[model samples]
Target: MTHNPSPRSRFGIRFSILARRWRRALDAHLAAAGLTDATWVPLVHLRESGHAITQKELALLVGVDGSSLVRVLDILSRQGLIERRPDASDGRARLIHLTELGEQRVTEILKALREGEERLLVDLADSDIATMLECFDKIEERLAPATDSKDTSR
Candidate 1:
């Protein structure tokens, strides 16, 4: 007889379940405002920058590859939510800018996201939430140095 392993032992499976759940909830919220999670992420980052950002920088910030970023940018541009303009210093490069519609859509989506996040953590105490956020920040900080080191070595 063959023995079966516990599903909880699989970290990827657990993470995938959590990710899908979060994305489903977020996608529903964004859909009400005529947007999807994929559309909102990049736009939110661009809005935060508040200035024209190069395509390379945007791709890095969004944690996606150049080819994938180009597809996302194309979709957003087609929807009139973003524009790609020639870079002032490097004519060969392009800068991505959010349109007014994009800005407004992001504002609305952010509000919804905040609400969704609040709902997700509704059962957790305020102190617990604060501690969770701090832990996440620490994890990011620790990982960032390793990532930088690898990039530099490459």
Candidate 2:
């Protein structure tokens, strides 16, 4: 007999494909600004944080490994986009800060991202957007326990 999959399984596969395509589209859109998903993701997270954060915190926020984040951070540092400052409270820790130029780049990035999102989502009605967000929120909430369990297991 041929194996069959449920709607939930198909939903998961579609969601993953959608996420990958979205990232690729954003990467292309940000190419003119010299930003890729790898680089701009960290920068956007840093800007949203509004204050310097530790590498570990950023790694978690960006859903990347520490070593991977370090490589990206090194590139950003060389580009004068970010600075790693010694944390005052913890001598062993460093806080990542966006340089003046980095802040300006992030502003431009945000504007570009907004325009891109508007273009893509323009066909969707307000209620459709709201419902999609609600569905995503519910999925995130449901996944929290699985995430927490894995984190604790490690």
Candidate 3:
């Protein structure tokens, strides 16, 4: 008798493969903007913030410790993509903001990322893409419930 893999196992394997390929392509595109995957997370957070933000807040947004986040921020600063300034209200706190050049580079990186995602799904029909999105939404809703304890009721 032949054995068949469980659906969960197949899904996990495919997800891993797809994630690696997607990240690899995205990383290459980001390199042209003088950035890397390591720098992308914080950069995205800063871009979304749209104005000067505090380092402590940025750390929370990036989900990293102060020491680690400092290293990434240093790299970005060295590249002239970001700047750090003292907070007027706080004596010791620092504020961060993306430079105009950083904003432009991020725009290019975003465009490249969109194109890469489209390329990855090029073989799928529009209907398939819609179905895949719907299934993913349902799966996420089931398995990745809201983090708030009140939402989970457990």
The candidate that wins on TM-score is 2
TM-score of each: 0.74, 0.82, 0.65
The residue pairs found clashing in candidate 3 are none
Residue pairs clashing in model 2 are none
Ranking by TM-score: 2, 1, 3
- The local distance difference test score of model 1 is 0.83
What candidate 3 gets wrong by more than 4 Å, as runs, is 32-34, 48-65, 85-95, 134-154
Model 2 TM-score relative to the real fold: 0.82
Candidate 2 on 31-53: residue-level lDDT in tens? 86676889899999999898999
Better of 2 and 3 by TM-score: 2
RMSD per candidate (Å) reads 4.3, 3.0, 4.8
What pairs collide in candidate 1? none
lDDT: which candidate is best? 2
Better of 1 and 2 by lDDT: 2
